[model samples]
Target chain A: MTHATLALLTLAACAPAERGRTLVIAAYTTPREVLSEQLLPAFREDWRRRHGEEVRFETSYQGSGSQSRAVAAGLEADVVWLSLEPDVERLVGAGLVTGDWRGTPTGGLASSSVAVIGVREGNPLQLHSWADLEREGVEVLTPNVRTSGGAMWGVMAIAGAADRRGADPLRALGATLARVRVMDKGARESMLSFEKGVGDAIITYENEVVVARRAGVPLDYAVPAQTIRIENPAAVVDAYADRHGTRDLAEALVAFLGEAPQQEVMGRYGLRPVREGVDCPDLPALSEVFTVRDLGGWEAVQGRIFADGALYDQALSLSRGQR
Target chain B: MSVRWGLAGWAITAGVALWVGALVALPLAAVGAEALHRGPGPALAAVLHPDALRALALSASLATWVAAVNTVGGLAVAWALVRWDFPGRRLLAAAVDLPFAVPTLVVGVLFVALLGPNTTLGRALEAAGLRVVYAWPGMAVALCFVTLPFVVRAVEPVLAELDPAEQEAARTLGATRWQVWSRVVIPPLIPPLVAGGGQSLARALGEFGAMAVVSGNVPRETLVASVYVLGEVEAGQVGDAAAVSLVLLALAAAAQLAGRRAGRWLGAA
Candidate 1:
């Protein structure tokens, strides 16, 4: 090793005049196009105009379950954007995110998409509602709820519709899973399976169907009468942002997602806007919709439906018994 | 010996011990400790849960099928390369080791593309009512593909060492081809075949990447133990994942030890 000279020591060139910062984002698999193309770039431009310094971004995308677990297990992401509220709740429980994220930064919600069903072209089977999926000989594709937070939204939609009709939600869930011939770990994988001609119908997001259709895959989607609103949350991880000193940049990107310009990009890319006035005329309105808060909060619903020995386990056993 | 040489040997031995202790033994010990962190009772109960039991049974059956298929397939491949001077013999020999080099996840995706519902063969198979992908057949095939190299590599050395002179003498002694082959050729190959099958069984038990893609992951029906551990982890039940993993690790470890013992019994090692 060469010894440093006195001139170099006197220079003390640690901080450059145009210092750069990195904002790391760990997000769910969906919304990859919008975030990479419009939201992130727009935020970078906005930050450069204000601060006159360059800001770089690093992003990783995975299924909500794995992505949330990665943040909790020390991925050091400045921002954690995920599919559902429970995933953000996991980080809060891990003490990686602030407890009151929902009160600020746009109620901790970045974008929205309602659960919908995708079927073959022309709707030969006419699978309109969740009840249509329970028909005999109709093969349904869904992800395992145990491994996917997005999958939980699909289950809740069906169960909520079943409850609305005075039918037993548990039995309805059992019947739906019985016809589930293809179940993958993530909703995206389930969609791929559907694209590969593996299933008669796929229970997924409206945005997924819209995105796939825009990509020229010949498919049609049915927005069920009674559906669940999918609210995707984005927040700055507290400990990670503090450690990286990128909290302001991280917070700005998330807040930008809920603003008019980026929210319009989110709508164009198929994800619904979190704000009410953002115009996405092509996206259909849900006939009847419910939020997670309408049923209960994330903690209550998680325990009641998905906990061990809970309703999902009962549904599995019931479905097996039916088989 | 001089003091330098003596010191070097002692240091080398200690270094090896430390390396193995840290790299191999410590992680396994941590798994065991985590499994029993809530005590052995909960760990036992975790494995004995209904879903866990079903997953364990599925995993064991997959291992058994992989072992049987690999043993037969591996012997045929090994026999062909050793006994025949056919066209493209060297290419065939090189191809036998390809499975070991390929990542098993890619192997799973390859199987999916070749035999999934969209393909012509896959469609014909479905029309014939033989569901392959997302079913038992696909899981078995995926496991067998990943483990085939173990048995083939194991049997090749033993098969190549057999002497032509001994078989010729036996044939000259009024022994028919079948009798000569059965009596002389078969007995010596048994130990290596068993050893190879054992290795295949151990490997199949712990396989995750391929099985994850091929199996539909339905609980109590198609879900295997390793995938079940993944589900538990994704569900935020790390304790349950550790317990089930401990059980799988024990079974795989037992299979490996059995294979080593069989190899040593015939000095095949």
Candidate 2:
């Protein structure tokens, strides 16, 4: 090896062991990271003062479903702050949580909206609502709903669109789904992919669009006539936390997220408050805009849209036969 | 035997075996254990998911084509590097390794810059009524870029070790150039080619970065098995994701076995 390489290797050998009291956390994507880094440290300090316990977060960021699966598969999470409600329901089903979570925890944290169509700067399609996505040359892009929390919301929004249209909406959706040039696996991946010119428009969360726009991505979010409100649910993994005797602290942290201090952090990340009147300049206030709700729970949604993966099969068959 | 040395050797061997057992065997065991869950129903269902199955089929075909292309192209490039005295020969050698040095994500981004709708080449292609960015062709291009090094690195050293006297002797016997290559030169290169092809297949199958940046991750058309497994995991279906991964592992193992059998058959011929 070269001298520089040898020296570098020698320096690496002197690295210190990890320190601090680690709190294992499972969260979904960008919002979780911002919450942990910017918000949680302050909360941790507060907990130390009140309870005389020191804890630092060691977190993993993944898709909502994936995080839920990890918990199901015994990933040993102290707390799970997820992107949607259905994921939390899985934990309850697994018996990791006790009773209804909304009654047990610090109220509930649920105030985000599902993805909307984010168009190019010029608005070339003259597009509005889910129907506009069905137009030819539209080239829609959305994170795969099967994997992303935002995608769950997006699926609800699509289903809501079908409901508004009445009679038949899948036919309209299928055509729009066909025009989608890319389906990113996650929200951030979708953002980056969209910025790289993969498609004419993207369907992602309003907050993601705000973040992207702040980063100077040439995109604009157009809220359709009806869109789903993203109901993000956070809860202390009761059995795990109670076993560790961190229950009081865990309750406090979850409660803290419900109040104004946590709202400030969510606001910075483009997450609208779950309740009304905690206004931020850039984001749409929760009360003003019309956000749609999914008619079914996670299971039903998965069963209809993503369970069989038929859509993917059709898309592949179409592309393969072409080239 | 020296007592001190013997004890040290036994301890060292035990330590190494234990480390390997923990690192590799445990994960493999977990996969096997999980595979046995639901009596193979979940495993079969996971692999049979339309999106995953499509990705599996697409990834396999793409890997095969990419490996074949690399085999021929790599051999030609190795031959030129060894047999010719072109200007900037050293520079050419460095350039051949360029794909390895650059990150795969950057390679995908580079293609986007060159062929995206924003670029002149993109406009030209657009005018020709052709699309390259979000198509199967783009995926092939990305896979080719990442796997380019394997075949070249495998063959180059082997080709260098080959003596020139064998080629000269064949020519002296009035054998044609093609005859010399087919009968004398191609035989020993089989092992390295198989090795390179296997490595390339593994790399191409696991590839996510390039496809993520360039091919658009469109369902079925561009969603590779790795990305699809990730999608399942993200959907809060660990059992399904693990099942998909188990299926991918099985497919990879089968491909390797087929490659070995083909190598043996070619060697016998």
Candidate 3:
């Protein structure tokens, strides 16, 4: 068994030497289903018709931050679909995606979502707003910010709502986090923990609840009065694409994702369309919505909100007990 | 007898040296470079960071607990397997090795699945004010599950080699159960037990897969050093990751050396 595993790993090590007619995609975990089940097939079918040959697809899914790091560490992915703009920014900073990648469709956003609170059947605790999560004796589930893009979104939603209400954002986040019984590694894990009857509530993506309900889970969710609009970016990694000569194929795949028909599939799968006029029936109209730009873009918020000794860090410490 | 080195011996020595250099020395030096490249000040600050300290403390306590439990439990199980003539003796002996065979990640999933809040036993435990999953108990249990075989595998052979006649002689001398255990049985067992316990401690300290799943990983509460390093890497803090890892690597080396030295001392005594 050990020898077999070593042989397989050796094979994998050498396999990257030959880059065949394959569009290698590195993506965050949540979009795995949509990309594999619907989008990739459609793209492959279209590619075969256009190029008169089958274009094989190779995909790897991981947490957004991890995916970005992997690509930066020379994962040789022709394209990267990540959960946030900051991740794409990291690639650009690493000089991996050198093109004016943000000049693409929907200002570089391929899919969108809104922050939400997923609750158990019947909404027994009556959770409606971010403040509701801080109520005494309510167990909440959220992912860890360091490992999960979704967790960052969840924290921003909580802190943003608290800021909007003139409350101390750090205190509010700390209070809500104190009530969190389980902080899973990612948004999907947090939702899974909620589904397993772990917590009274979970702060997650609207698309998460949508996907869950579609999978026949009796999960219910609420779009808070104030929430952060989620944006997921897709870009071609110029270096890898140029190396593999798959720049066109990779670019086409990125473009194919934002087209109206593909946007419809993403909608049914719970992602809001970055493009106009695409409806996701599962997503309710949130009364008030904001974006990362509104919260002072990713740059302004990074150090002030998430860096060491910042609001989020202090809140995390406060969740356990004050220093 | 003095043996002279041949070409084959030289090739073998070179092969082993290359393996150690490439696999162990290279990564260690790389981590050290990443950690200390900014000078000792930032590296020290990173390790001494409040969150990093908390994670270190949590991992230490969890490893201590796992080592103690596995040592005692493993001894009992090994004793039973060596001494008893039971129907399922062979099956039980084989089952003890299963924990080693199963992936640590699967061990974590097993604990979470069984003790989930929705389960009846889990609800009862919660009602009793003892939440397991996402709590310290869950973390300890997960670590224990993964580190179970360490002590058992280490002690079993040494235990099997003990002479039955000596134990019987102590009994014949009218020594009480405790007397026989302490005076006749325990001295020989001490070396293996300490060796096994130390091995368990070292393994538990670095356990990531199971603890990552079972522990809620809330900062300053459930986060352990290994998981904290992963978190740092994900957050794009490679320097912080390397610094935390350097600290852990030093501690693990200290622990393994201590265990081996102590085991040798005990055996000699």
Candidate 4:
């Protein structure tokens, strides 16, 4: 027999007889990694308390929107704790999630604010506001909105600048965008690119910059005058759990987000509490500090301002000309 | 008893076939059906969007350049390692596999360290009026780094197996060194080169880790197709992403087929 046949048989035979378990997770950045790492032990402990069985989590964490798309395409994720509301709204539109997915918890995961441009120590160029991005010789590095969920938030911050600038921040923004040296597909790369000196500044999620600083990357964040509030939502994958006979465990896992876990785990990840009375770091609040709303959503925004090819072409032309 | 065993064998085969049909092939079949049936409404809209097209073009162009350059580089390296026994020759021979052993992501980070703006080399390049860390040149460099192994490995064995008598005969016929290499040494290398070039092209086309780290996935600039597909996938646009992926797969497959055909032609020649 061929190697393919033997491998198939081996995989099939290796299946556990008692019951199998898997958690379909959709999260972004290192916090997602932390969840898969530090919190799994605790979550499984909670699972065994209610279900009397061992469990496993099959997680996919990248940008929030990507995770939402996976679920829409029949990935059958049990919990989708993604970075933004629109991602959950995607599931809502597809009928996989309820419109009230946000209503599940007041400030559970959706309570995090959008990121600001973080620069290396000493504030080189004295970057004070979003307007600084327009300055010549100022290199801005942000994640590609096409691949990064937080990148949409970054676009919203810039579009807000356009609105604040009153007619044609695109020109100003375009000039500033010309300075963008790197456009990573993910938030972490955006940070790493900046730290690696690919750019003078980067616009990313606040949690991401914080995580970078925590990881000893030597960076500081600058909140723009305007920014978007990033809401992350969670849900259970019904089909996969039922198939794996881990329904009791799945239900317990989702239901466990009631309050204590929010203050304990999600809060530490820089996500504000959905419900009141949950303690966290004394960071600026998304509500009090920023004029927040979706940056015209994906359907509205993609073709107009942030279409992938158009942006790249313009950037490419600019870079080539300079070279 | 033989008939019974045959029936059981057929049953097992059918079972495994059905399982594969349900899981892997079924989803792909769905994508194929969707791609073929779905109009330019979403997919075409995405493709026509300058960013998607640019990514496609950039990825294609990079793959092409990588294949061409690596063909010459691979043959030279392989010929030297196999034909010549210079000092530290064994070390150099093993070094060809270094690209293979290093993760693409790590290679990207390495390049970022070596050529990023912060680095002395990168700073010097920038001062000299060039940007290599986050531009198309950056993408090309990263792709070349990842795809170096394909041509070298492919040609190495072929060169090793080559009969020395043929080259001696060519030299004996009063052919000069360059002429003997051109007429005798290169002919047999063509088939393997074509085969290796095809492999390199396929890899360079799909390569994500290195390109993602370096190119910054700038639309129309550095956004390669794989990165674009990833962007689509991330944005919860599976149909659109799948559509992009289908196009990419078709292109890669076509390139592979072209490579094989070229190999056959070279072999015949």
What are the per-residue Cα lDDT tens digits for candidate 3 across A1-323? 99999999999866754533888999877887788999999998998788776777889987787788889998999999988988888889998899998887678888999889999877888999999998888988888877788888888888888888899998999889889877777777777788888888889888888888888888788888999999999999999999989898989998899899999999888899999887777567768898888889998889789887899988877877631
- At residue A182, give the lDDT of candidate 4: 75
lDDT of 4 by residue, B23-125 (tens): 9899878877666576767777766666577788888999999889898888888888988989999899788889889999898888888888888899999
lDDT per residue, candidate 2, A202-253, as tens digits? 7788877877776787777777767667667888787777776667666676
**10 residues in a row with least lDDT, candidate 4 chain A:** A286-295
What TM-score would you give candidate 4 relative to the actual structure?
0.74
**Decoy 3 TM-score against native:** 0.91
Give the per-residue lDDT of model 3 (tens digit) for B1-269: 13456777888999999999999999999999999999999999999999899999989888988889998999999999998889999999889888789889888888988887888888999999898988899889888878888788888888889988988998998999899898778787878788888888888888888888888777787889999999888877899999999988888777777877887798788
Tens digit of per-residue lDDT, candidate 1, span A1-323 = 13466556555543432378878899887777677887888888999999887888889987788889989988999998898987888899999897477865468899899989899998889999998988988888888887676688999888878878888999999998888877787777788889988878998888888878877889999998899999999988988999988888877787777888787777877888888688887787668988888778788788888888888888888888765
Arranged by DockQ, best first: 1, 3, 4, 2
> Which residue runs of candidate 3 sit more than 4 Å off their true CA positions?
A1-20, A49-51, B1-23, B171-176, B267-269
Candidate 1 regions off by >4 Å? A1-19, B2-13, B176-178, B262-269
The positional error of residue B170 in candidate 4, measured at the CA in angstroms, is: 5.2
Q: How many Å off is the CA of B60 in candidate 2?
A: 1.4
Residue B258 of model 4, lDDT score: 88
Q: What range of 10 consecutive residues in model 2 chain A has the weakest lDDT sum?
A: A285-294
For the predicted complex of model 2, DockQ is 0.45
Q: Give candidates' CA RMSD values in order.
A: 3.5, 6.2, 3.8, 6.7
TM-score attained by model 1: 0.92
RMSD of 4: 6.7
